[model samples]
Target chain A: MIRILIFCLSLLCCHHLVARKPEPEHIQIQPVFGTENLKLNTYYLLNNHTDSILIETLRFYISGIEFFSRGECVYKEKNSFHLVDLAKPQSLNISLAGLAGLEYDQLTFNLGIDSTTNVSGAMGGELDPSTGMYWTWQSGYINFKLEGHYHSGATKMQQFVYHLGGYAYPFAGIQQVKLPCKPNQNHILILALDYLLQADFSAIHPNIMSPGAEAVQMAKMVAAQFSLKE
Target chain B: MIHVPLKLAVICFGLAACRSNSSSFEKPAEWPEPVYDFSKNPLSTEKTTLGRALFYDPILSADNTISCASCHSPYNAFTHGDHNVSHGIGDSTGTRNSPPLMNLAWHTSFMWNGAINHLDMQALAPINHPDEMGENTAHVLQKLNASNFYRQLFYNAFGDSTATGENLLKAIAQFMVSLVSANSKYDQVKRNQASFTAQEQNGYALFTQHCNKCHTEPLFSNFRFENNGLPIDSSFNDYGRMQITQDPQDSLKFKVPTLRNIEFSFPYMHDGRFKTISEVLNHYTSGIKESSTLSPLLLNPMVLSSNEKVDLLAFLLTLSDREFLFNPAFAYPKELFLPAPKD
Candidate 1:
């Protein structure tokens, strides 16, 4: 009788050990201008290395991360909203505590906040309005912002600013990104600005402060520039 | 076993305390559920008190010369009385007239153009506009953090001494939502505690026939965007809703202004174009400018005789809730602004 009780206690201990939570997995986002690391306020070559451009600010939101295996969602991050700023290094690394031991072949995330969260009232943490990502003139978040100057000629600089976001119908700017990934690996997602800069800078309007067809088009172009670093 | 009932009693007492705290924001008997999700920012007496103080404080402005109440004075039905367009810091004038503040919890969108989609984000427009408060929200938070009085107020309201933009906006919203103007004569009549005069009764009939579709009963607004045909002011040239939606069909379209407290909330129209209630009536009867996006209901001109206009005006007066305009709670919180208690 005593041997049977001991056997039951050992089984319970094994179950407890098996159910222990695993350590969190990390995903690092690296922003680059072609092969070089992107730096704010620093001049970089663009448009086939013919024009000099300086990026003063570059910030965008990444949210609603989900991991899928064989077309089934294996893990999803709760309240997954992150604001990645070129000026802030620590913010680029996202820790997914839920992704531990998950054998997922696909990673998915929204390039901007979902429409539901945009309509919802004041939120805290990284989604806070004080983060300067929210548009005060209108009730929506600025999903992606890039402001800088382009050198038209020596000593002649033209300022360019882009504030891209809209959650309303007929002009939703949020982009969903799906990428293939290896199982049990820390991922590095690279945002290649060179691809984004390939657009005719002088031809397209340099300023896009409000949401419209141009903002949506630009947001789509920006979303296409993200890729898994090889 | 004895502690179980004791714990249940304690929980019941706690719930009762919470109920008493939110008594300031009571919904009217027949009103629809408020569009604001109260679960996100629950009403509390302390938060409302803090919000009232912030609303009256000029520290929200960059020059410390203007406040929300500067233009939205309580006596004027929370509107800028006699001002065609509201002037802000540095005497800079804004293009649109300041909208009155009442029954905000029922509103799903704000501004004359419906530019703001939520009540919580409405204050940002005036606060950040250069011609208004001319203040950055982050800078405003920093200033609040610097003040000992605000720190205590923040702590009392949110249990955190540090002031954040989220808390600041939420606190202000608490005060605005509490400004319910449900004690008007019309409301009293609706509740069967009072009766309308014969002229008011006739006017109410006419109202139901002509204006009730847009300016609905109870709340006095359908809260939908419509183009009431006022000719474009060449000076301002504001294409109201089209500016936000970027669609030509929305040109000249504006959110239908609530007729509640219309007697005091003039000069009327988005730009305060009409000075008196009669002028507004005249525009409805004769001054509708034709456009492709004109409201289908207004395609046919309204014909109200002069006597009918007077009756309409008299009925409109019944919407004036003096209790709301003179509520001491909504007035300037002089007690809070007094020198902070010595540390």
Candidate 2:
């Protein structure tokens, strides 16, 4: 009886020793607009991030989330929403709860608001109007909002609303953004407002208030401003 | 948290939900089936009660001044009586008049121009518009969350105590849906419980031929966008559905409003341009704008003489349901409020 009791105690101890400790995750974010990977500032770093250890400000909305590694797509939530607004940006603290120390070479997310959410009721977190994604009227939320200072006739000006959205045609709001990971290290994405200035100004329409055909066309014009490092 | 005795937590959570102690609202037997889709959100007394409370509460406005009931009073078939243009927060008036809101289940679209696509999104227009309530949903939710009454009501309407935009819109829609009106004299005439006078019968026949194509029987509106030609107002120059669609072909078309209780619902048209039914009839008779968008039915004029106009007015008067207008269930809940609302 004594030997049996001693054996049971040893077995319990061995089981605990084998319990695995949670480790940091490897995550790769890819922004896809239509059929292409969306890159920003010649580097596919994190595009729209709420909180990040790598950067002070990374603002954007993740329209769609796609997780995959080794050609096998693992996690895909069509409506997994993520908005990285400066007003309510989440403090980026890496955790193993979702993506940690896992081989993920492929991931995708949306860069603008979708139709259903645009019509749905009050949303918490990134969707707050403080983020400036909300339109006062007639319908739908602004998918992509960017503000920055630039030289207009030689004087630097600020306070611009780069609201882009249009789900119902002739307004389509599909913004594709890509965040490339630096092998083995999380990346930082900085999309300065200079991207709009770089593009042909004639294509961009400022101060959009609803999702319609014009908003979608402007989003595409802005998407043309993005590029990759490698 | 799970391991502790759960009874105390259960009791607290149950109290927080504030489920109604009253029975659910019932419909009259003679009424037709409701147009609201109930499968999405089942009807329960708790939800309607929550909706009614929200409807009456002034916290919905930016400055705590207006509620849904402010413009859509229960006594006027859920409409503002005698207001051509609706008055909103801070005495700011809207361009279009406030229309009656009962029998909403039958409406294909909302507003004078059918701007809102769904019933759930209707309140957003008023709440967010600068000239209207000027309140944002987020702030409204915060105010509601602070109140024990609203939190409990939200909890009861939804399974969770968390007040969300979905629950708020749903609650509002539930109340609007509950504002069903179908017990008028015209309804009884159709059901064979009563018969109309000869003049009224003649007016209804004229309505069937000349107006029924647009204002269909039973519901008294096809809910279509039509250009019943009116000269543009130089001040407002509002071109109803054309603004939303942007198609020149849809230029002057506005949603054909229901003619139910037409006598009380007027002044007619989107802009309240016609203060009397005679003016409206005159426009139909000789004032149709020859735009590409005008309804085909109104291209030719109908010459309704003065006597015929009176007959038509007689028909419209029979559409009012005093019982629905005076329903105590829809009245202010005296039991809940500390002080009754002032007239």
Candidate 3:
């Protein structure tokens, strides 16, 4: 009967190309004002060549937005965590293709806040540590609070502010960043806090709210700001 | 989002609904272990009568003329006695000196320089202090949800008629944990039904040898933060607990007051400057000031005599109780705020 209907239409087109699934990608760290403004302002101070010193307020926060296939690690939580905040850049355009664990490689979380959300009481957007970034009085949670007033030249031009946060134990804000993607499919990462004064931390100790150990040196000056545009 | 509740009902519709105090009774025996954590909001009795009617409502003060009994006044013991400061709302005052809300369940921290670490958020620092009770916890929860007796006493202690600032700081931590004073007279000499009198037992053996290592006794206050030496009021340059822990070793310290009712919490430290506890035992036996942050038990200097400051003011007037200072179930409920206050 016509060669058994051409072997069942080649086994239903190889089960619709191995159950198509891909969609998890996003990369919008846009904030340029130097190297001739390509446009994206919330006070740009981007960084590069690993000297990382992007100032004028660049924030960070990402958590398990995961999705992979080949290297494992399937799709993640309902809305795990993501607080970019250039004050609010329309939720930084992210899109990770049709996910379902297809050999994934990188993109883990935390550059701050992990004392189980500081005793887990009251939380809204921008991870609401009551957004004074919390330090109403000698307590914790100030993973980072740059604050401005730069300039330190010849005679009297100093007004720097740096309210970095702490988690207390000798003070901690445990930062982390990993990049490299696609074993099966899905990836997107771009956290660029200007470049955090090229990781020198304005020669260390600008300002910190509370926690301990000078917020572990501003979480190693915000994990040296993070790169890899791929 | 619990802020102005209808301009807080044209100034507290007579402290709407407040009258709950039963303290579920059994908190008696030896008493010293509370530091307030009733496991994050427990004690009921309609949340201590809606936190003693939002602590004597002047709708928690903004334009409704002060009310945290206008500066902790459960008649001198909740303490505003002889006003050494603490005036608030148009009467302005305060640079420090109100200190007298009783036993705060025992206190791990709360102002006088501890700065609110949680007595359920210390009535949101005097209800949003522009200068204490300037009212604004989402407009004091829209003036207790435009009171129908505080939405039925917050639907009988939080079944969500909604007043939130965490249930108005857990209904003022259930009327300051029903202001438990533990039936004073040193709790009737620890319930041996009272004894003391040998000039209040030589002022309780010179207050357990110079204030039991920072007032520690049946809840006298081992809450620590010393520096008792005074001297520094250059017009309230008050650096108590080092202006909230910028920490120069908690410079000019503070915290430690609870001598229970130190003869009606008088005008003492934190800028009420010795308004007599015999000028605070003559400045702890002749005004000390070696201060590298003092208090190694006031760093040596305590002479007394003059009948030991009248037997330490007769053992601080036996930490007064008057049934917890005339607690007409913590008065002013005037059948839910009417025209009382004639006294």
Candidate 4:
């Protein structure tokens, strides 16, 4: 009878231990282009540019998400790569399950595909080869894709397609980004479309489909355009 | 050191067991860790057999007439030998020569221009090219789904009959990664099991001095894009690496081809310009065209006498691995595709 009682106590203790660890909380990452928080295919005016221009397509990969508390990393999502596509509005919002009760003060992630995955063979999920983000001619993933039209004062509108990608030395496109965050809040990351106005459409039209100086420059600019949506 | 042989015996036994089932990766001696991450797509005999079937099947192509084997035949070291350039569906010729496929597990990039980055993604180009297979993934999936044979094969390989793009590409990669070539005479010499002939030894000395920098030992090729001083073709005007990078400095650079199985893999170079190995040597020795983007190693002319050239060619033959070329395991899946005739 005493032995049975001891077994029951131990079972209850194990259950208590498991109960103390809370379930993970779900956190969402919403992508916004300028002030509109608009859907894809919507045209927006370029801010502070000499000519009026509109952006129609914006897509990129966000990966290596980690959460830190008191400067110590507490939680990191396993296989944290995501493709934030504008054409598919659903892909823009990434819902991450954070550890329960662990205070997350800051968030960090990559704005483009990491070099490791680029060298590794075919992958599925968001990083799948079917995503159309992969360059068929070249082996690496396009870090980000920005396509739009620039309207000159004259009648002809110029189309601009910028595909920024490179994984080798001298031109790695992956950029690290960190931002402060509150737990469980729907923090939206804004991609400042105005920064794109700096591109000289006439001089560098169809810029950077592969690795080079132009690709590295555009990737740096795209990484800089991110800010917490107010 | 006395018990080292026993330890080796145990390891060899373990490796033999692993090879019996095709799901494991074997790291050869002195090779760098493979770039292919097998964790994501673990190899299985079922997956590899299915992939081999897919490689030879006309079902992947639009017209069901052209397969990967059409351009990359197993007999010719996985490269078509009849034509200078690849002939695709409808008898349309491609601009570039089809590269021979082997030792793919180590390659960081694919294609002559280093255009395709991954081996898994390499098939997409030939599959979708208008002159090639001319089929899209959606149509190919539909065709694969319709076939009862493929349905069962997919079920056995991936636990279900659904022909998704992920499983399709992963299965192909499984077969490709298995094409390892480390059984050549040169490899045996490196292992101390064999000795080079006097002629080959002299050739090895010359090769070490002139070629080892670009075509590194063991693997044979450094796999970097370099302009080997080939003058731009006036007709084709193939500015190799520049087309991908769009940088003028990168113009005329092409991925260095491996010299393995050179005896069989003829009509060489990106455009299949050299029909014989002697022609290739002559070009390297005297035919180097001056260019700004030429590889610095080739800036100074190669000073090989006629006798040294013969010796170098003799050494090059040591790279041929008959074990890889004639491996029945890599041959067509005849039992799966064709019905056996009753005696």
Candidate 5:
């Protein structure tokens, strides 16, 4: 009888240990130009398929990922910062662990690094200054970078480069994005580059390197392009 | 209940160990809390020693010709003496004067125009500037990784041999933030350990009346970007703070520099326009070119008699901290750099 009781208690302890382990969840980010996948150096038709744009570089930061269920936060990813680059295929897929059994229907994240992290000196991993996403002339992370050439007509192809970032007042460029998601399912987040290309390039100017009113406006346009892939 | 006392003792021991590890950086009792956050990058002897080596290493610059100390020498209180502007890699001359690097823990921003927001990020400006070090952080990391000496230093400082940008910048910041200059005779006078001469006392009074608003006492700088009414030098076309902020109102504005070690840090001003303190005093009295954004404190004309200028100069001399200038700990680490470590 004593041996049987000890066996049952060991079984219960093993079950508890198994229950404490968390399962991994993946978040895949897909960058697209219109309905097609984004390809660097490939010209894509824009503005009712009239103007053509050739993307040379596309890099941005995604940070502060959090999940919500029933209007309450269910899970927040620790050290949630990822640098997604068009050139690096592996960076597009982000694996989040220790989120097993989490009931989350909504996802929220910052399109750029937060102000607190910006002021904090020197960070490793995706937020590292060596990533080239950081502004060297000034001390702020470049939230979104898109460099390419645009051709409209008989005019020469113009280069359009947008490096958007600023943490200070009157021009803070970080944008928060929230999307509805199905619980317990791997998520696919789509970033549509067409919406950003649709803007009148002449009025906005093809070159924006520093953070200012133009950067803030451009960041807002870019932030609006993120959506959950159904 | 008996175990609780043992736990308390363990906690106390842990706290003591932590304190000893970070004791490399100390805050003076009279000064305000430092602007640089210490908790993020705690001070340690190994890290600071590594930082000192990096500060003197030319590998940070392109062509390995110039280091930070080239432009910011300790003898001149970190400013390049006799040079109006900074001379960089390939003999390139920069537009603005290289500012001194002391009491940096108190400064909230860096550069003449306050371009850098943090000390860790400040080195990036010069390292990448075409007219300065002319090297990118990525290449610098590759070079550092290739060097066995740097690898060992990195291992000692960060407990890893690989040279990452984060650790590199943090190590450099440790050396910079450790440069605290609070041991001047002026400070001693405030501490009641010394007294100022009658001439210095008169000069101190004059300084309080004329310059104290901008160059405040103790740290000797309010650290605000103010247009001090100097006419723009069209050659450089440098708009000072306006270049950074894109605000027309900030035109001709520059960060107010600390008055400590004013005696040795010659050729003053953002452009190093004045060669002597008397010349600087002359600018305040007669050469303030009025502008839309001129500092309000300088809005009124300042008139100092020649004798009063002499007295003020005497008071400024009291700010020169010989101990800080000659501190062997702050000097070049020859033992670490010479006779390169074997791989």
Candidate 6:
């Protein structure tokens, strides 16, 4: 009987060992805005521009993350959509834990919520309508929101609020961004808005609450700002 | 060692009981599969009840004066009769008519213009519209968090008292999708439980000939956007689907409104231009304005006589499901909290 009991215990131990799943590797993507240590609502000089601007809010969406190497997909984050808000430091950090032991040369993601989820009604989690990224009157998610004060030539209102978003055809604000990355180590994606400082605010429309040529232009402009940190 | 099998059996039984507690959402065998996936947002009695309460509560509004029920009244088949265009908080006039809410699970898109594609996200439009609720989700959450009644309700539905915006929208959607209207006279006839009258039968034939292409059976909407050639209201200047798609080809196109419960959900059409069913039929027959983007079905004149119109109206009446409109489970939810508002 003792021999039988010992055999059963060994079998149970082996079964436990076989049942264990492999642990996935974790990596973080941090959104560091222009010139690092840039505080919100603080007046700063724009690069080679006469206007001193104060950025109050900068929020945008990043989705459909795909890691690739040698023209083959190494890892693809399932249902990967994230809203990165500059005001909230925690919102800037994204976890790539699902891609454990994956080696990739490049990664690609969209700068706006895809058309499918935008029309798919009230989604839960980050895609929730209550997140303020969603437009109530017009049915679409605002891809990028940039609100700040720009030096106005003569207008009484010096504030500029550009809520750029639209996923429909012709003027679709969905921008695809692909960047090269190191193979083995974890990656941190950086978005530098310094280009906006050089960009003439006088020429750009300030208020873009709906889908139009202006919203599309702003979406493209912000999408071009992403780069991998060294 | 002997008790191990017994423990496993108990766990299995418990899981089975939990699954059984969530009564399966039934889809009528005759109907096509629903567009809304129930697997992601499983239905439970508690969650539905919570959703029903939220639907009736004006607390969702900025001033706590307008609930979803304000525009979508159960008595009127979930649509108001008094307004051509929906009236919102402080009597603010909206641009479009309030569409009736029923059989939404089958719908792939929402709104006359098809601005919203998903039923779950539909509430955000009204909730945040300055003319409607005029409240953001974050503000609504703050109000819900302060209420002891909502705290308990949220805890009962979601297993936590903290009312997140996601949970709030999900609960509302759960209630809206639970509103299934598959027990109309037409449905009864289809199920072999009852037969249509001669007038209704004749009307059904006429409908099949003239309207069934767009107003498909069962759900009564093909759920496609079409320009039915209603002359543009110069004041509102609403371009309909073209506003969203930006393609001039989609000009004046609106999502085909469902014809179910047409008896009560009157003040019909996207802009509520027709008050009576006869007027609507007359418009189709005589008032179809010629347009570049007009639906191909309306390209030729509809030659329906006065008698055929009556027969068609008779058939349309059979689509009204009183059981669905007056189901106590979907009513004001007085048992849950406050009494139903007296209009």
The candidate that achieves the highest lDDT relative to the unseen native structure: 5
Q: Which 10 successive residues of model 2 chain A have the least lDDT summed?
A: A49-58
Error of 5 at B291 (Å): 1.5
DockQ-better candidate, 1 vs 2 = 1
Tens digit per residue, CA lDDT, model 4, A1-230 = 99999999999999999988666554344445455665555555555444556667778899988889889999898899888877776876766675556687887889888887887777777877666777766678888888777776656577778888888777888888888877754667777665565556324745557777778877777777776653
Evaluate residue B47 in candidate 3 and report its C-alpha lDDT on the 0 to 100 scale: 75
Of 1 and 3, the candidate ahead on lDDT is: 1
Q: Which candidate number maximizes TM-score?
A: 1
**Lowest-sum lDDT 10-residue window in model 1 chain B:** B1-10
| Better-scoring candidate (DockQ), 5 or 6 | 5
Tens-place lDDT per residue, model 2, A142-201, is 666654333343343323345676555566586766544322444333334334434455
TM value for model 5: 0.90
Q: What digit string (tens of lDDT, one per residue) describes model 4 on residues B102-198?
A: 8888887888988877778888788878888887766787888876677656766777788777788888888888888888889899899999999
**Model 6: which docking level applies?**
acceptable
Report the TM-score of candidate 1, chain A only: 0.87
lDDT of 2 by residue, B258-289 (tens): 77767667667777778888888778777777
Q: Give the poorly placed runs of model 1, Cα more than 4 Å off.
A: A1-23, B1-24, B339-343
* True contacts reproduced, candidate 5: 0.84
Candidate 5 local lDDT, B1-343, one digit each (tens): 0113333343334433443244546888778888998889988876787788889888899889899999989999998899998899999998888998899999999999998989999989989999999999999999988876676667767778899989999999999999989899999999999999999999999999999988987799999999998888888988898877888998889999999999988879988888999899999999999888999889888988999999999999999999998898999876565543468
lDDT of 3 by residue, B167-275 (tens): 7667777787677777778689879898888998898888888777777777778877877777787887887887655668778888987876677777777667677
Tell me candidate 4's TM-score on chain B. 0.92
Ranking by lDDT: 5, 1, 6, 4, 2, 3
Report the C-alpha lDDT of model 1 over B116-209, residue by residue, as the tens digit.
9888887788888899999998888988898766776677678787999899988999999998999999999999999999999988988888
How do the predictions measure up, each by TM-score?
A: 0.92, 0.79, 0.34, 0.78, 0.90, 0.85
Worst 10 residues of 6 chain B by lDDT: B1-10
TM-score of 1: 0.92
Q: Please give the DockQ score of every candidate, comma-separated.
A: 0.73, 0.23, 0.03, 0.40, 0.73, 0.47
Cα lDDT of candidate 2 equals 0.65
